[model samples]
Target: MTITVGEIKYTNAFPFFYYVDRNKLLEKDCHFLIQTPATLNREMKAGRIQVGPISSFAYAENVDEFVLMPNLSVSANGPVGSIFLYTKRPLEELEGSRIALTTTSATSVHLLKILLKQYVEVNVTYDEMDPSFDEMMQDHDGCLLIGDEAIVTSWREEVETYRYDLGELWKEYTGTSMTFAVFAVRKDAIARQRAILEELYTAFVLSKEKNRKEQYASMIRHIQKGMGGTTAFWNHYFSNLVYDFHTQQQKGLLLFYEKAYEEGFLPKPIESIKIWGDVRTHHSSLM
Candidate 1:
């Protein structure tokens, strides 16, 4: 049977999937379906897609049913291009203001709450608003945005904003690389199709290297269009956005889950969840 995969449309997340599709690396029986991050999580939770990359929070939210694959993710140590908090007031002032949240990003919403509670020392009201940053900025003191929207809006001059980089904050608090997203498979899929999944993961790793050199220009072009930035901006952002999946990064993932649980953001302990794939199977020099 063909395996449907859900993924985000942005360049940072698409290169690996694009490599697989462009090379036709999967088995004849397997096929992939690409969708937005939100749609991907919805489909995975509903069991429509067997495997795909998704937000770290989504994986935590549905931890029991999925297995994390090795060697592929969208993450960074200090600055992740996709997730941001834009505010007219400094983050410290958010203590008493109403904040508009971009409902599209589960990870960012939780990150904002976690950071605010830790730093701002007061609870703030959260209301969902249209994903448009302008509209959100008008009615609320600040806005949370992710994916291409954050990238495009970060360069705006009129928004008198103080940017809160969540990835950086995560690193400061945890002292490890933050995992913004990960490639994961359903638990049943891992049990039934372990061999194919392994091959797919290997292919994905090789493809990432290949694309880094052979398709960098195309990737930059895509980012420029999707993110509304110049080639230089895309180049800088892509270079800074680390994609390596390693044990060191896993420490951050585990830490995020651990803290989220302790802070009551997660419903249960992370140890109870089954992460798909064996980390020992893959080794990376980058970590």
Candidate 2:
């Protein structure tokens, strides 16, 4: 049976799929469904796709239905240039003010809430809406943007806005890395197509390595054909966006879930993160 995969169609997730497309590994055996993170989150929950990189917050809520892909994630150590909070005033001064958040983000919304509540100690009202800075700022004091939009907006120096990087904020608050997204597969999908899933996992690891070796420059140039931002900006942006769920990232993810649980962002308690297979021993090529 063919494996259907849901992929986040953004620059942050490009590294994971770049090598797969370059090598044509899934040309016949795989089907890809690409969309924004929010759409993929909803579709995955509806059982429309077998696997995808989902928001860390989404994984915590669906722990029983999903298991994570080992050693793969969209994370950042300190300043992730992709997730930002653009505001007219400082974060501390935004108490009781209105903040428009990107509806496309699952983790960022909760991250912002945690920062505002626990760190900033402010009581600001938040509304989730489309990620348009102009429209969002028209009615709100601040707005959160994730992925490509946030990257693009941060470069707009003439917008007269203060850009707060959520990843930086989380690190400052918790002193650990932040994992925005995690690769996850539905539990039943794993049970039914274990071999195919293993192959895909290998492909993912290989793609991540290809990205680290600077082989993705050509692919990034191709995607930049019509996109904003210069090649240098894109290069630096992707460089800061990391892709491994190692010890530090794993700790960050669990800490995020714990904070979310304490802050009531997650409805249930998450004792530990789950993995699909033994990542360390399952790196052999399945091609």
Candidate 3:
């Protein structure tokens, strides 16, 4: 069975996926489609794609339909310099002001809301808009930016603004990492094509391990061209990102879901995150 997989085109994901694409790690039966996080989320929900690295909010929204690909995610412990909130004034000072949330993001937007409500305790209004710094700052007191655009803006020396990394902010508030995205497969796809899905998962894990070398930095910088910032900046950006869904990352993700739920961002709280295949079987046995 040929399975369609979605990949997001972002520097944060370049390390894990760059080698996968360059080496053609996916088997002939696997197909890849590239798009933004929001597009991939919509495609996966609509059954147009079987598996994808979707926003954490997307998974929270449809938990029963998706099983996370074990040991693979995009997370950050602190200061994930990419997902930023460029503001006219300090976060606490933005009370009752309008914030322009990026329409391209689902998770970051929710994280921002959680931060403001749970941590900052500031009353504000939000509206979705295109992620242009100038346009966002023109009318809104702050703007949420994610992926490559956020990274570029974060490193801009000319743009002196209050930059708050949502991941860093989440860490400060919860003292845990923030999981932005995770590779997940539809429940129907896993039930129907278990073997193929296992193969794909194994391939993905192997691809990540194979490219753990420092030399991959040059390749990553090449892929992230025109996103601004120096190679070191890109390297550090990717370095802060974690791909494994270990205990710490899992705790962080669940806390995010909990906070989002308390803030009225999530419709309901998720009990256990479903994992694809027998990846968690041994761990489950120990427990």
Candidate 4:
């Protein structure tokens, strides 16, 4: 049987899929496809892709259909280079402000809304805007950008922008490590191809180690070719973007889901979201 794996074209997700594609790590029948986060979520929801990295919100939104793998996630504590809230006014001062959102990033957008409602206690308007930072900054009170677009820009000087780092905000509010994205496999897929999934997980662990030691050169090369940015920019991103497969971060994720539930962002409270394998015994190669 063939497994269609959906992966996001982001630096954090690169190490997970890159090694498999480059080395042909899977069985001959198994295949993978690289896609944007939105596309990945769509395909996964439709049961088209058997396994992949996906938005945290997608997993939360469809918790019944998938199970998390041990020791793999896209997360950072202070500043996740790819996800940011750019605004002319401070988050606290943005009362009745119109915030522009990138339609592609459901996780960040929902996160921003939850934060604003909880902390700011302000009623704000949300509108879909162009993904371009400059364009969104022109009309909206603030804009949320993700992926390569957020990485390349100088938000500090370019515009009168108040940066709200979502990851940092989450840490402050929850007192737990934040998990932005996770490696999840469909229930049916895991049941049918347990061995293949285990092998894929092992490959990810190996690649994570090699990626850390080598400063993610191969992943960087792939991103740089598509995203026009300086080495310094990419360096800052790589340095800050952490790849850790730890069960410890589960606390933060649970808290996020709790808050989302309280705020009515999720339809119901998820009692528990467990990692598939034994996290205690799984040794990650991430250095």
Q: How would you order the candidates by lDDT, starting with the best?
A: 2, 3, 4, 1
lDDT of each: 0.74, 0.85, 0.80, 0.76
lDDT (10s digit) by residue, model 2, range 87-183: 8899889989999999898999999998899999999998989989999999899999998888777777779988899999999999999999999
Query: If scored against the real structure, what TM-score would every candidate get?
Result: 0.87, 0.93, 0.90, 0.88
Q: On residues 1-287, what C-alpha lDDT tens digit does candidate 3 reach at each position?
A: 67798888886776556545422434356678888899899999999899879998899998988889988998999988779988889988988989999888889999998899879999899988887888988888889999988876766679978888888889888899989999989988977777656656666666576556664565666765655466676667667878889989999999889888887777888767887656422111100
* Clashing residue pairs, backbone N/CA/C < 3 A, model 1: 67-276, 68-276
Worst 10-residue lDDT window for candidate 4 reads 278-287
- Cα error, residue 117 of model 4, in Å, equals 1.1
Model 1 C-alpha lDDT per residue in residues 98-197, reported as the tens digit of each score: 8899867766787778778864566788998768998998888888888878877877787678888888877777678888788888887876776666
From the highest TM-score down, the ranking of the candidates is: 2, 3, 4, 1
Error (Å) of candidate 1 at residue 68 is: 0.9
Comparison by TM-score, 1 against 2, better one: 2
Model 1, position 42, has a per-residue lDDT of 86
For model 1, the run of ten residues with the poorest summed lDDT: 278-287
- Candidate 4 local lDDT, 41-134, one digit each (tens): 8899899998878888889988999998877888877677778888888777899899889867767878888878986688899998758888
> Looking at model 2, which ten-residue stretch has the lowest summed lDDT?
278-287
